[model samples]
Target: MDVEEENIESDASHNSNELGDTQRLHITKYPSQFRALANKFAHEKNLKDRRKLLEMYGNHLISFKRSILLNRKRWQQRYLRRQSFLRSVFMQQLLELETTFLELIPILNLNGMPSKNDLRINHSSDVCTPITRFYKDLLKLESDDWLAKFHMQKSTFDWLCGQLKENGQFLGKNSLMGKEPPYERQVALGLYAFATGIKYLEIARIFKITLRTTICRIMKSVAESIIKTFGDQYLYMPTSEEELDEIGEAFYSASKMPPVAIGVLGVCEVPAKQQVNSNSIESENSTIILQVLVDNNMIFRKVKLDTNQPSLFLEETNEITNLSPKLIKNQPVSRFIVTPDTYYPLRKSLMHKYHDPVEPHEYDFNEAVDHLFIFRDRALQRLFARWRILKCNGDIDLRTMEKVVLACCVLHNVIERNEKTFNEQWSKGPHSDNTKYTMSSRFKPVLNELHGKPHSWKADGASETRKLLGQAIYSTEM
Candidate 1:
């Protein structure tokens, strides 16, 4: 048996050696295959463990996701609540601020209540105490000085004041509360200041008024009052036959001609500053033409103003044509006769004696008689020069100028009627014989036919009238 065992052992040893050798050979030949098989087995084991872990934690993951979603929703709700609370607080604050501002408005004294000094400066200075003092000073002046300054005597001023008071409906009373200036004083100051062309500042100083605008208002009020009071009384045509006869007699006395000679026609040039409306027509000499008709007594029968010199003559004729038919009762009164220097239209009815040297005798005779008629124009000129306001040398517009002239004319008539003697300065004797006739460019050839077409019959009638008048005039010596 021992021998058999020994044999078996030897064989096993040999087999073991053979196996080892074979294994070595395989490893050397296929090492990559061995490594890949090992890796595949390890990966499969890891995948199996991971799948087990996923199965175990699946419920936990779902619960965690739900909890996160709920927490996020809670945070969002908290944020919205905080924003709403802030907005409400801001609105409440704004409302409170608005209420506070409203409550404080009345308590804030913005313009500091006017002091006593301010009241005195504003009200007392403009009231009537100063005016009373001014009137007292005016009364202290002599009658001649008063007349020279104010263009009317004290008695006349008082009469005018009384008349205006009697006709108080025309000049409304001053509504100012504090003792107001007397109506007479206000009217006198306005008339004197405007007629004399005194500066507003100068007038304010004289009257002790505080404001220049006050003087201006006073002037305008007084002027309108005067016009309303005396316009119709003084500025009307002789209405009755008796008045017409009287005017006719005055004319006959003036010219030594027949009663047919009623008035003289004339023009005066008033220089004015440039007007604001550029489209308005302006004369070449920058003047406004004033056409005036004066009766034998040197009273303004008619007055018209034209923008240009050329239009003045036509306007005068139109005025005369309108007025003549109303005045004359006998015939249609084809036209009227006047001693117009050369500017007047030469119609059969309107006879103009030329100032040519050839007709010396006729010229001399006419000149001697024409002097009486021409005196009216000279007197009118002097009257205009006397009223500086009517002349309007300063900045005055057309409307204001018209008012000034009309007012002055009314005042002129008033003074003329009231005064016993004529003012020597305003009314000098007849113009000198050596005075030369001045021709104006206003007389153009186109304007010659303005008086309408002349007929032979009209000319014959006018000539006969003139001849009879000339015979009558020459028969009587001046």
Candidate 2:
């Protein structure tokens, strides 16, 4: 079974490719390079040696094939078995990945990479030296154990067996390393669960174990293995210019177009259960407000006042007065504008704060999304695709025409829903027909206006040019 013979066997399987399924074929039936490797290393020299080699390789191949088949089977079976279990596992894994990934997102920000000065050792930090010393000492001992465990193979067992035959004291040498083998089954099952979005509790039911124990075992094993294998390799702040450039490139690639003028709005929602007390009732109310920032093709230039202690303020301070002196002196293509009915009033002292040179006031958020939608309609009218207004968590709930239409505005960045208004309206409703007509009629022309814009034929062809991106950033501060 050389490479040429392996290809011949693979060509045989090609005939069944039209069957439109590959899972049914056992892996051993499809020849691989491993077969040649196995034959070259086979124990015997006779004709029977080749047969024995094939048999051993066949078993290994079958195990590999079963692993693949089981993955697809588990995904299809997950929903039918236990729905709650699957949902929890999916949510947990998704959240875990999201949280970890976002921490590194500042690296991908429009602002250039942090300087060497930024990452320079802070000798002033009291705990840094002690923590570094502790980890350095610990890793030495841990590395030895890891290396020893990793290399203990069947050869080690065979060596011990030979020693046992020569001396009585070494009779149980093979049994000296009495530690149980690693939980390969648990690791395999955990990965299967992750890839297929299967729940540990459902897996527990399949394996005849308790739900709690199964979940604990799967998470501990899977998370620990992932940490040990990768171990903060990709989990670092970008300190170098090249690394920062790579991060920015990834962001630009994901975002497609550089955000012309970025409008960031944070929404905070509180659960119903937390609203029992009066103070909690007020606190449970979700807050939604917009932040105006200048996002050129490059980094996000946050307009801050000199007196403002780099505050993450939700209140929208007035644009003309509160901007940095340089921005006021030379307004860029974009100018920042905070909503008037903001949580607070724009103070007089705040008005005279540091203003940087801005690309004079030829830009605003009012026209940004609206302009995009207008462009979307003219250029993308012929496209056929489902238009969804997804929530922050990516749940699409477009049940009504108003919901559908509103979602279109949000998706295309035409009109941002006043979250407070929508929430109040939705919550106060008594399922009145008049209310539906009122809301729908009010926003109907807005949608019609969006759809009625003229197209420029000289530009790109009438393809799906405007692929709408709708991101709802929710605030967890509440």
Candidate 3:
């Protein structure tokens, strides 16, 4: 491609509008610029110049290390002072930081790899030498400052020259496609510290780096990185039967059975009391109903409701009798809307008590957004894999297959938020004549299946009801 075409491709790939500085550095469209920048700052011409430059950068590096060490010490102090609340938070942060930094090492190493022939570094000696030296000094410092041993010797000049050739001549920003720049590294380290919730100084020590760099990176960079890289993916809401099944399974595995779940939103009127001791059941004003399905194996079946759906109560009330008769009667519902709104108590009761979740309401919206986003993402990936497998296997009824394909495509497109990425594939429009052939070819079999088979869920309503009731019961506290 020509420069314009290349630029377009590069722009598409890099797409800085959403990415952070660390990501931009990794793309390295301007290796030459980074090289020049590094060179302009180097101090060493001979060994002395190398030492001076190394000393300058070395101080920063040492300061960074010290800050981390100090921060860690402070954290330990705090933990000792408070064995209860603050300590757990401190420990949790440390673990998160360690995991993030360790994960980044491979990316950094890949980016920092040296060229085979040293073509770029040698060709751009003016800039390359200084940049190379800066790293060499870092390495030297790591190697316990070997220069001290060679100091005051004739070999010092030769040693400095050797270091200059090797140290200052760095692989520019693009040297490795995935690695980050020094500045980006600073920011990432800071983020690592923040995420780990370690004492800032301690995190600096762990990374062998600076508090200022860490602070700046977290405050200005990491959140954006997470957003750009993970964005809507982090906000994925589970929508598929398979995904719901997996969640049910997870809840089942994590908690116990007999879970209760409310899927939709609506209001329901509940009665005050049932027949007891030969007395008539008392009438009561309508209260919010939290329609839940108590089930073992989850199956979605439509249930007719007598009144409005459930509603959330803002304050505690003993008027439990005002709830819908259907709910009070404990009839199993396939999908029930806990009217008004679902709150934490109901959510916890569902998850911890029963275990089924149509959707989670226990956490904040942002938290829910983040979680469901991950859940849906993993589910879609599984769907994609399944689809590919099905396609590879071939020979299924075309109409049935088509429905599955279309559904998969529709769901995947919605959940992945990849409209821009898959624009070409979907641009014809799902319903367009151009897509009709492909759609028909795959969906014909799915339609045939629908015709041949009565809905299994409909026939199995009783068993499904049992399962739904179990889900509902398990979903809440008694």
Question: What's the number of clashes in each of the models?
Answer: 0, 19, 82
* Model 3 C-alpha lDDT per residue in residues 419-466, reported as the tens digit of each score: 221222212222222311111111111111123453342353433443
Give TM per candidate: 0.58, 0.22, 0.24
Give the lDDT of residue 69 in candidate 2: 59
Q: Residues 20-92, candidate 1, lDDT per residue (tens digit)?
A: 5543343232323333433454465578765654553454335434544554465566667666665555654
Off by over 4 Å in 1: 1-119, 123-132, 166-182, 210-214, 276-288, 309-339, 348-351, 357-361, 420-478
Name the lDDT of candidate 1.
Answer: 0.53
Query: Which residue pairs show collisions in model 1?
Result: none
Please write out the lDDT profile of model 2 over residues 188-269, one tens digit for every residue: 3333343223343343433222333333444344444443332233222233445434533343343332221122211111
Each model's RMSD to truth, in Å? 37.4, 30.7, 34.5
Best by lDDT: 1
Reference-based TM-score, model 1: 0.58
Off by over 4 Å in 2: 1-181, 195-201, 205-211, 249-478
**Order by TM-score, highest first:** 1, 3, 2
